[model samples]
Target: MKLEIAQSTPTAASIAMLVQEHYGLSEVVESEFLRRSFNQVYRLGLTDGRSLVARLSAERPRGAPNLQFEAAALEHWAEAGCRVSRCVPTAGGEIAIEVPLPEGPRALMLFEHLPGEFTGDTALDIEAFARGLAVLHTAGESYAGPESAYRLDLDYLLQRPLQGLLRAPTMTAELRPQFEELGERLQAAILALGELSQVLCHGDAHGSNNFIQIDAQARREAVFFDFDEAGPGCLAYELAVYPWNLHPRTVDGVLSDKAAQQWRHFISAYREARPVPDADLAAIPRFMAARQFWLLGEYAGRIPVWGSQAMPTDYLRRQVTMLRKWETLELPL
Candidate 1:
């Protein structure tokens, strides 16, 4: 999509006008609600055979200042014939339009709705998906927008280890001592691992952030979205989260042998696509611990698990247990 002269940031009236101007349609006869996060998305059906998505960013100034990066990324992918969304330019030849926000302005862009579904709960085509990831990771080297940097580190890990433990009323006296022991071991482990690992990483690669869908013939396809957390970090650190986070819920949240199996499978596939150095592999166990500690620290204290209809209780219990397990696992490095 080409950049065009900016309009007054979109309003309901402006969007209605914009859609008509671009699509040559008289009205938005119907809309299928899509997603509601920081931004609101809807699939708009037009009088013509074509359809388009309308994005209404939350009225916060500078919250979503532009969609330039997303447009560039998707356009680059599609131009390379990658299976991804194709950006559609508005009638005025602009890919994005600034919308009025309370503070300043938010930006909106429309994308050709791509096909896919959630990479279901288990046995997802991770191997195939890893191949796609390799393509993205390697191709992404040409990207110039956001500078990737390691966002999760040893200090960040240490700051939050005791969080969830402190919340569990059932946390026993023995567990308290265990937590202390875990903390010391983890501190040492992170220090040692830090000496060996660093790289451009996906700060968040948990399965939930990905989409897995089948085409008319039942062939599976994967698309990873939500790049907000993509930044600089240890590639090993990023990869370690895949297996543990893939669990539908965290009963103990510990890195069990079961979780390790998932890791082995996924990593084995990923390695085939792009071999990880032994030095990085040696540091992964400790990095996994740091990730768990980071999670417990960031959420357990503030986010309540009950009645939110979100993840199950056992899931969290498992996560806490996993953290303990991670604390004990020795890194190869």
Candidate 2:
């Protein structure tokens, strides 16, 4: 009988060989596995001391079409002068190369390695990160790429996560009703806000996705990467991700004054580049809650491959607690 594997990590030696063969990078001096989460990432070092990143998609519902959408969006954004990480074409001039793996066929794409550090929560860093996101939103207005297979809509953000959470074996029975009620409340509140501005969202615009570089003149620049979740979505959702991510970092489980001020700076910087409506600003809190659900669903759905330890009972409870805290917490926006 053939051994069934849910996922597999290709050795760095194999990756180096593959990159040399397909990408025509004859001077690859190092190939190292950087991370393995929703996808697998590898760092390839060239003899000239330059590096490139190789990302292999895991088995996802969106499949190759999603990658195609990302590649097209990246190309479009780069041409429009947005500081985004660019994808490297294969020797055959293809943006994505398909590789058969133990689980399934995964799409592999090489990218120009961005040289910078992840942005911190400092005011200047937050401002620069926010401005970069705004630039991306503005540039994406003219996107004429292939239609994405998915959207960050109510179904994808709320309903699917709710379903995944409820079906997870680790979910507590007592929390089931609470989860259902919260999901309904979130859906109702967001729907009552009427229509929101739709744009090509970074989908995962949290601070860590981009790298920040400061020049000798003290000018800050951010180069964004990881467009796996990029697609057409509500502008509010895109902006909410940063503040939503900040909530869990506070000591008191609420937005600290400093965090609130930083959020204000972020919004102000973004608005300086692009206009955001009052209604969209007001809808951010609701979308923040929706972000929590999206994350819960993401973890629950991946439990089979990631295993139970990744999403222990305590972690689920802590997430639920955070969600509850968000319901009563007031945001600066």
Work out the TM-score per prediction: 0.61, 0.94
- For model 1, residues 78-170, the per-residue Cα lDDT tens digits are 565556555567767787666554445655666665546655434456655655565665555566654333245555455444655455554
Per-residue lDDT of candidate 2, residues 224-248 (tens digit):
9998889999999999999898776
Cα lDDT of candidate 2 equals 0.85
The candidate 2 region of ten consecutive residues with least summed lDDT is 59-68
Q: What local lDDT score does residue 84 receive in model 2, on the 0 to 100 scale? A: 87
Off by over 4 Å in 2: 61-65, 249-252
> Best-fitting candidate, measured by lDDT?
2
**Poorest 10 consecutive residues by lDDT, candidate 1:** 302-311
